[model samples]
Target: MSSRQRGNFNYKLAFKLFSSFFFLSAIMDVLAEANGIFALNLLKTLGKDNSKNVFFSPMSMSCALAMVYMGAKGNTAAQMAQVLSFNKSGGGGDIHQGFQSLLTEVNKTGTQYLLRMANRLFGEKSCDFLSSFRDSCQKFYQAEMEELDFISAVEKSRKHINTWVAEKTEGKIAELLSPGSVDPLTRLVLVNAVYFKGNWNEQFDKENTEERLFKVSKNEEKPVQMMFKQSTFKKTYIGEIFTQILVLPYVGKELNMIIMLPDETTDLRTVEKELTYEKFVEWTRLDMMDEEEVEVSLPRFKLEESYDMESVLCSLGMTDAFELGKADFSGMSQTDLSLSKVVHKSFVEVNEEGTEAAAATAAIMMMRCARFFPRFCADHPFLFFIQHSKTNGILFCGRFSSP
Candidate 1:
């Protein structure tokens, strides 16, 4: 197949694998509307052309990381030019070719970041999708490194990812990714594409942002400039653990974020681990955060992060694509060879206007909430979980967001 065809095939393979681990049945109670919407949004942001079901673009990647589908254009041709200017901190993008050459170079250059792609390919399922995309990919990744400190192969991957992100968001997003994750000895680079865009969903009317007494946990309350918004929203419920959910949308109606809190006390820190699509659905039903006259106050902040997937992917059970001695990467090298390496990273940010959310969630919401007997107020630190329902795994299980 042609290079673009190969890239497309690889992306599909990876996505399908990503889907299996995530939500294989969108309508079978396996995926939530948020995940479905996010999936569609991702395709729309990347390139959704019905004609070219399998075409390569700046918005597609062969494989890597937590199987998080940050973004992709189904069939439309990717706009390579637009990626140069988007300065939006919450998004990222990339594109690359010559899978074999790149992997070889990364292995030679990234000498200090080995052990990054730990388990490699344990519960891999993208084997088929990648083949359809005409690309070969597997998970073997870890967190990203700081810029200015990137090794050659890592820098190259960053270049491609940023290129796509900048072009896609019209420079609204910047290059916030690096590669110092694995050892240089096994730093194998591969062809791939990835992007993340987290803008403000509610967009705390910056003009209306006010300093409110932000209750942390039991006895901690700090005056924080909280962003406030009033709107009819989608809801979810967590059982007795304590909390209700609010699904807010952004400008395009393609992306969103889920916020959860306890019923009586917003002890966010204690319940971060229990937040998920299933739990949210359960919590929203049992607990109601949207009480009558329920005015919501949130924060306004943005975190643009990029990390290597080598380690995390392995941790999630994907281990076969990185073994140079036992790998089967002839598709990339055109020769009998062991799998070299695969590096994948992404960028994401959560802001006030809305959330330009990207890939992955790490269950870590730590806060406390204070509420009265019958009122449902999420005004405290409660578990904040971000899930990709597709994989049923939390892409972002943290405890923070702004108005």
Candidate 2:
């Protein structure tokens, strides 16, 4: 009640707020690094064939796995923490809190764009999962643990989960889990869905879009509807990889599509081989890009892709989580549980107006879990990413190698 006491109290409150902000910022940086590393790793894994196109939301996949990581214990938790880059972000509660903060920021209301992310846990009605685990998921990830009758109604449970994912993603993603993906052995399933729609700050004139030749490779070519625009945009060049970097801002500027186009003489594989988390950070730094009026030509394309993430995560060193004997998820329940499957599906459409993208990821424990732009010109194959400017988090990323 005293003046000095009041002053001290105010100072303490301010300091606490500052500390919290700093902590959250550090966590975001760690997450961004993790996302970048994982994105490149996934690209390399899925892009073994240079002739195919690869697309998915790294954020969606990470969010789904982080929920499973919440229940993981011992080696299962350790491997997941390492693979998901939670270990570098201080691990344990910090990782969850980081995601909580991130989800809050990305899903903020009143933004000019539409970006929503939702998480949920569908557990077998008969299983006795720990109350602490359920509470923590709800508290830190805004994910509710829902009880489902996976034992007797396998097909119904699958449809229910798919329906939820479809609803969350505005119907952009449906049937995330196919008919047999879940069965009587399934006990728990963790799901995460993200949807985003935004308009370009400087929309390309629709009339300017024309059918153009897209060089798929030295010996292959396809016709694509190439959108064209000349505007002032952030552009950079990476001589090390013979790549051109361009930033295409969406309306409100909170999100942007970044494109990396390698010179025709250099194969995209070369650029992929040289990409690392550190290099990605350096290459995409705002300071490294300059704003200038340039002609941009990007193809209007739509991609709907699906992946079985069990093998992908396993190859990335997340083995114990899938191994029933070795897996440890004591924090979730006393039940001897192991991940059975991880299914992910994503849809994205890029056009003269802007972009709409949605992705859903499900970890069926049984359970387990689981662009720009620059278009100086994109007549050749290139890599692109839709990134959150504030947190530097990659929302969706892929290689547009084919039409």
Taken over the whole model, the C-alpha lDDT of each candidate is 0.37, 0.83
Q: Rate residue 350 of model 1 by lDDT.
A: 42
Instruction: Estimate the Cα RMSD of every predicted model relative to the unseen true structure.
Output: 17.0, 9.0
**Total clashing pairs for each candidate:** 123, 7
Looking at model 1, residue 156 earns an lDDT score of 54
- lDDT (Cα) of model 1: 0.37
lDDT of 2 by residue, 1-403 (tens): 9999999999999999999999989888888888778888888988889889998888878987898998998889989988888888767688888888888888788887777575677888887889998898888777888988988999999999998999888898887888898899887776666666778877776888999999998998999999987666898899999999998888789998999999999999999999987988899888878987677899999988888888899999999988878988898888887877777777777877643330011112112321222348899999999999999999988899998
Residue 58 displacement (Å), model 2? 1.1
Model 1 Cα shift for residue 119 (angstroms): 22
